[model samples]
Target: MQNSSAFKKRIKRRISGRPHVFFAVCPPGLSGICAKEVARVSQKAEEIFSDKYNISNINVLPGGIEFTTRLKTACLANILMGSATRILMRLATFKADGFRRLEEQIKAIDWELYLPSQTLPDIRVTTHKSRLYHSTAIADRIKPILHDRLFLKEPPRHYDVTGSAAPPPQTLMVRGENDRFELSLDMSGTPLYKRGIKKKIVKAPLRETLAFAILTRLDLSENDIIADPMCGSGTFSLEGAMMQCALPPGTFRSFAFEAWPGFEEKSITHARNRLMAAARTDMGVQPLPHILARDLDQTAIDHLKQTCTRHRVFQRICPVCDDFFNMTPPPIKNNQGVVVLNPPYGIRLDENNDITSLYKEIGHKLAADFKGWRTGIVCPGKKEFHALNLGLSTMPFFHGGLDLYTAIGVIGR
Candidate 1:
């Protein structure tokens, strides 16, 4: 616990120059939630370290937020924010109307600052409404320049993205629009949604980032209980329980930034340790709210039990193999709670599935047994969404290539 103060001073002293530009990427239409999470996490960092993390200049774009912050804060944001899919460090942006101009722009960046000589850069490019429209052609043009400039002396080698045979390749993202391009380094090698703890999954499991975003819309309090009646693999319950327990999303994973130049491993390790220590201390004094994770499929319940037990959060999440329609709301202290459901879309599990009956059953159960409780359901179609018969407002979003809406309402008002 005492080590955090020293770590705090080191971070405060190191943020001297102009802040770096970073973009927190998320699913389209949820950038607003991701931006809010960034602010909330930075505020918590300030309260803990007694210093500003300098996470400012938040510009919300169509798919993500661009913020200016020091490298350490960017690293911390990767560990803390759950809604962001990944964070990218913007290196440079310039006009690239022709291959020569593209080469010039690429040559201007100091590759050594971000990439080591031995690693093959994994570059991904996308272009729109530009003279240089072919993505592969753009990447092919940039690769040779990078190779000749960075690996002039080293023996040539091939490194796959998996890094199983060699070290992980640093990912470069190039996006071109109207003859101008933005180049960024992917600070997160793998998507942030794969937190490594959600090993147990069923058909069409919800992404953790999406789950976190839905929970953020709930406005949940510490005293509010969470119930996932159709909890296939327990995504909603586990995410909510983890939040209530103060577990950072990146707890069990490594990031691409750890392999970058001048990473400050010792300070980052200290900060992560401090965050874990604080979570433990907070959990010791605070009573955890109950998370009811129920599934009709016994196999799903069994898998969820294993995951919860492996992570030592079994006590907070009560898993049962029972049909959701047969269950009633569990007791709550304040009569305040929410029920979250991600029902089958009738396309994956079974072609003959009757989704309307399912939604109607869900709505009837909630109205009869869960009065005054808030609800969130992933409705795949208007027919199914209206079957609920609950006066819920819908927020449209996309997931799994399907246009969907998150229907939210209070039951039995």
Candidate 2:
């Protein structure tokens, strides 16, 4: 429990590196794709920084990917990445075998470098196989020390652990494993899946991240047409538009790092501008492929229309109010494109709750209309996915607390 000068130095060394470590939390079963996106964003960050910002140590684990880069680069990564759930930066690490050691080490670290004036940390603590096992107790011990450091310049505000007050700029993760602790700051305030544009949703709308993950598996490109026959809320269509246009996913949203101490506002702005410029340059004179968003529900079609118009991709997306069974592919050169389907599952079933018949009908319809075209369908399980009978490869993933599989393959292959 001794807070020696050596311990203070160790903490400083852990937190003061010019190249900070960051982890991109991804959806389960999609970490490989997320890692690829992170690497792509890292290359873009290097271009934006215009300096030798060495991005290295990209290690892909089960649920996330870890990498190291400059702080500004990490902020740009947060904006440019498409598949990650969020990004977190490792702030400090120390060993604290008991409450006294934890408290002493917490007091030894400098907080002003990370926290702005008059700000409090929203601490989330978790402990496993450690002496300080109570998460609430550890958070309680650490909060007052952070408060004392952050409120020195301004009047202290009342702390509310219930979160009735406005959300703090940063969320501090305090993870303890076997007497060792790691402190990480949430760089993205909201989860990356929340693209912040769709104001309307139908029953059981697909998540944006899952949509993007499926699109990635299909090798989607700007030249390839996208058809979402069961386009509920048009998540797949919207994500497809963003990808085709090379638009940064976080452009319409703000991040938690924007309010942190010593955030390079100018640099971040420059990076965004540079990304937009590159997108514009890449889209010169070449028309984006049409994304046909079709559904039987007129209300769903109307909502998709509004969203596409609001996002300024209305021209690129053709919203049609027609049953998928009665639909035909638009006149393209070779009908070489991708068809995505997120039909009803679980409680959103038909009157007889016969999903197999519905899936079989869908498979027949796609086989007839979209021959040689790639198709992706999200189903509740392998049993339902197999009902499609498209010979599509299946991958398991989780969304909305349900185990799901996306069937992917070319129709009539």
Candidate 3:
């Protein structure tokens, strides 16, 4: 339909195109929820790829989402998604009941398109229900072919497989199941939840990724004032403030895609611009007047301030040091809001070893101080939390442990 020059121009528009994308997740139970998040993000932009993409599966067994997207789209996902653990670039999938068949499939793909000749790739192989199930043997079978494809004289020895150093920034993961094999490359060198802004640390700080997951489940509104009375290192509070900005979880982190052979400059710049455009730029008008955090430990409040400052979110969060029993709710522009509590319990912290009384005291405070506020609390079990006498609903959350899930209800409703 077009001339040769026009065709060249069309090809120029697609950047770092790839065949497929896979977003690694956690806890087989959360696969459906992760699928919703993946779809929500993918609809924003699909032009980076040369053609339309399709979602293949929401894998419950391996805990990931498999979708067709370009390499550029993978880069965008690494910067934008919150629920995913890692973004994997799929190479090829084929029936491989034996090592010979596996090697043949690996040899067919164009490895040169993804890896520079001089770099090293960390290889990880896993097997389930396949005849060629020896992980070490699978690695041995595929490694030589990759080395040959890159024309490396000798494979680099003693390099850490998961290292993010300069020489080798790529990781290849191969999974064999049911007499078939699927290969993928890791586009996110470091996990996405490590936002790189936590300058201060606490003993049992909630994982940032998990924090975002809990926030998403709460369905928070920008207008809802938020408070975390037992905020350790300000994880929940900072997460709430960032949501007001619509900021991507990996906004400040480096990605493994930055080092790929197919890396493109304008593509990443465009992706960053796309994310920034999605960002809430209303600086003068914040979502809520109060997203407050308080802790009995002065060290935690100090750490919260430090972490928030390093994240450039100091103005948006309020940190206080006072015992939950003695402290009153922070005043907000609105009369109603949400109160979050991730109190220490069950060998994590709970230093005094008195979860029963602590739980009772928290219940008393909720009735006395927070009459109309919605509450989200992380607790070990519903029976223990129900002792507080709040009529809250809960779902099983796999992180921290199988015992921990978030409880949601309204205090004195």
Candidate 4:
């Protein structure tokens, strides 16, 4: 019985309670919006984790957030979150008053947590605001401490470690405020902003997160037919199509967490399987509804087509190169669809500072031609949307770092 108990303890140590920390970074102005998204997602995470593992402690932090989860729950996050950029496992957090203390705290961490057991570890350091302002100086100070702590045969030597057989972890994110230092291991090697598949970008492209935010705000669903006039790079259209189909946004990209220790291949596989299972074969509603993208620029249309191809949603969308006003909607049996437009603000088309004439034309067309349809227009400013005279409630939305409004007009009495 004693031997069996010891054996169980060892097994538990190997497989139980492995905690992971995640950090979600966003653009400066979008932090509050990102925070709200994080809160909603974390709530869902807590419910899922609690139901599965019978645990419930998810923490939200400023500038980003953190949570404690075992290996499987961490994998669940990668599959479930639309808002999170990357997941980081927290090694340790220490308080440091000065350069000496900071170096000592960094060195004291068990390098084995991050380094391979067989190789001599390489280290990199970064600092902000604290006394150790020079990142290179901080890196220099950290090497000897690691050497001493690990009890290496010889004193440490510095070498350029980039792409080395064992490269140091990409960064040691250090932030200093109020005379104290906070250190974190950058688990997300690349910024979450890079969803990996957006290889071709248009001029003044919208970030994926911002695109998702707009979709969320609009309360879009899979059943709705979506159209994007002036669809630069097809971001809104592509994101909308993917969302409607329940496809994972990260399906095309590799995540930072995949490279971490104890991350299970089976869990990721299962998540992907679940996503595939939920994916719909027919993105269009009955009678083959249209998800349309129209633009005046032939180059923009070509770019949109290429982007749609990369996203594997080319078949799901109909791309046309023509003026938005002249574009016609598909005649689907009896279902109504939404028409969305991201028109050029005065900033892009400098020839038109006072866009009242453009807005008036849009209003006239919608009020006359597409009377029964629902129209959503995204404009650079609130006044521009009001100028459209769509006779509907306007909800403010953010697009590409600009404060915009999405005016929803239900055409026809």
Best by lDDT: 2
How do all the candidates rank in terms of lDDT, highest first?
2, 1, 3, 4
Q: Comparing 2 and 4 by TM-score, which wins? A: 2
Which candidate do you rate higher for TM-score, 1 or 3? Answer: 1
lDDT, model 1: 0.78
- Pitting candidate 1 against candidate 3, the one with the higher lDDT is 1
**Prediction-by-prediction clash tally:** 0, 0, 0, 2
Which prediction has the highest TM-score against the true structure? 2
For candidate 3, the lDDT comes to 0.70
C-alpha lDDT values of all predictions: 0.78, 0.80, 0.70, 0.59
Residue-by-residue lDDT tens digits, candidate 2, 1-413: 11346634543454334788899998899998888987887777767787776679999986799998878878888787888899999877999998999998988877766665577878999889999999999999999999878876444323222122444356899999999999998988778887767869988888888898999899888878899888979999999888887878876677777766546677787787777776632324777777888888899999988887665654588889988888878755554698999998886776677888888898889878888898889988877887888888997889888988999888887
In model 4, pairs of residues that clash are: 21-88, 371-411
Show the lowest summed lDDT stretch of 10 residues, model 1: 156-165
Error of 4 at 276 (Å): 1.6
Clashing pairs in 2: none
Tens digit of per-residue lDDT, candidate 3, span 46-119: 54333454344545446777776656556677776777777787777789887778888888987756665655
Residue 50 local lDDT, model 2: 75
Error of 4 at 74 (Å): 3.4
Minimum summed lDDT over a 10-residue window in model 2 is located at 156-165
List candidate 1 stretches off by more than 4 Å: 1-17, 45-51, 149-169, 280-286
